[model samples]
Target: MGHFKLLDVFAGCGGMTRGFLDDGEFVSVGAVEVDRSAAATYAANFDPTGGHTFAGDIADYTNVPRADLVIGGPPCQGFSALGKRDPEDVRNQLWREFVRVVRESDARMFVFENVDRFAKTPEFELLRTAASNGGELADFRTQVFRLNAADFGTPQKRIRTIIIGSRIGPVVEPPVTHAKNPIGDVLRWVSLRDAFLAGPVVLEPGVRDEWFPESTADFQNFQVPGPFKLRDLHVTRRYDLTSEIRYAHIAPGKSRLQLPVELQYPCWRKNPAGASDVLGRLRWDQPAVTIRTEFFKPEKGRFLHPQWENGGEQVNRALTHAEAAVVQGFDERHVWHGTKAEIARQIGNAVPPPLARAVAGVVADRLQAG
Candidate 1:
């Protein structure tokens, strides 16, 4: 196969770029991102040797390197299913710029990704119009597919929409190689345990002063028994604890029926607003729920530590930045450069590398066949 070049837009921390680069057929030429922190992180990781980094608004930029493929995921917050479904949200209009760049570039193929809700939005209608006038109708064809990360072998159960446009005939969707395993099976089936085995548990000194204190008297109130089990802790003490609990009906090596709810967490039904707001725990054997930018903010979703207790005084923190990266299919060796919060946002907003790899593989195959 001939060498192919790629330009990534709205590329948060180079998730898609990393995937494409991994295939050995494509090279990441450049990327555009808006958030200064996220842009910095993407540059640090993707262009560590110093390459073009566009920190400004993508809409204002016109000149960019022409490549064989242009790939990007516009910010989908305005069109996300979880937020206010305002059709007029200005952020939804960013898709037009993505289409604009791809249409003008020399690239023969483009991939646009967004939340599944994008399919139902008026923005989609706008996309269709733009594609028609942008010359997609005459020279290129487009198809959209709603994909779940679990179906592609990532342990996380995340569903996203991917739109592919190519100048060369119809774009065929990639077939699912991994079968769907229950949440429990996915967790136990991976080798990440060794990959993430507790590193030096460094508490940020700043976070310590904010959430804990050096004074023994102040710390005493938060102290609990060492190595206490999550089931032993009460629910009232932890404000972040959810009420939803998962009982193990089936044990490892046993039939699914053997699992049952062994214990209930206190905050299970307290919050009615979102699924992650209630008490919940992770099954050791299954894939994790979607890792969101709000993973650090337990109030935003059900990101509770699998071992956190309801009322336990122990520090049951949200998933660390490194842990979130692994669950999203990034290698443990992949360096993330930013504050925990900044890295979390990048991970939350990124396209899972594994999914991108699958798409890139298909594109590579098409180019090879052509």
Candidate 2:
């Protein structure tokens, strides 16, 4: 069977695009992205023909070519748990553009991804109705499901909502391909310990590039290689004396809730029950919390290492870019460009590639069977 052509919308650093292509059953024909950093990252990894990766707003994008499949995860900040779910956020309207492209592209199948909370919004139903009643997707069957990356072997418990549409057959959700740390039928969830090993490992520039090479072949088969350690990493951010002293009291899996009365921040002290993850440390035995953009800062959430002893010093630091990438289901070979913040945003905003691969596998099976 010929490879299915894929058009990726809101293709931030080509996570979904890479995921689909990694299966070796789909080829990305075009991608639309507005962020230059992300767009550059996309170009670095994908070899889309005709330079079809538009590094601009989707609103201005036109003359899009039809494809066999359309896949994307639009800007989900509006529906995310981190921010105010303001109904008036402009990013919310991007879904309309997604539908417009899907309709115009006349793709046989489409996969739309977003935060799990997106399902509760009125637009969820609106988009479904629009896709079902109008344009090329008029007869397309649609299914909406909330899926966890952990279910597909990612070491982070990032939950996302995926909406699938298919005219070829009923859109079926991908089966859970991996159980957590499997020990003979007792399927335990994949833990942070499973994704990254303890590392005081320093990453030299040449070694980092070698591990995460720029070839699609490398990216496709990318793993940490033998004796896996974090690379393409970030320096541990230093904390102020007061913050350091406070953090010293927290243990693995514990947060400010266990801090001494004097160590609690004023806001947390006033509302002791609030912001449960502040100053929290992750448990090595469990999967990580969702790898948010702010995961580099230990104060942001439970981003701290469980117990990484660095050169005989007991240091608690947040996940490095490489560690966070692995936790998000990206292999060591997936490279990112630009500032640390820009790279973190790209990684955080992405659908776990393994999760995307699972979805793409189902779509590919249906398309091939036809």
Per-prediction TM-score: 0.72, 0.84
Give me the overall lDDT of model 1: 0.60
lDDT of 1 by residue, 1-370 (tens): 2388788988887888877877779877778887765666566566654466676688876778888889999877645444443645566557667877786667788888877677887666666655565544346667888987766656577788888877775657886655544353333223223223432222121112211112111111232112111111111212322322232221222221222333322343342233534323343345667888867654455454444334542234455554566667776435544444566688888887877888888888876666
**Candidate achieving the largest TM-score:** 2
In candidate 2, stretches whose alpha carbon ends up further than 4 angstroms from where it belongs are: 48-50, 79-92, 134-136, 180-187, 198-230, 308-313
- Kindly give the number of clashing pairs for every candidate: 27, 1
**What are the RMSD figures for all models against the true structure?**
10.1, 6.4
Where is model 2 poorest over a 10-residue stretch in terms of lDDT?
204-213
**lDDT tens digits by residue: candidate 2, 293-357:** 88878878988776633344445566667767777877755656556677779888888898898
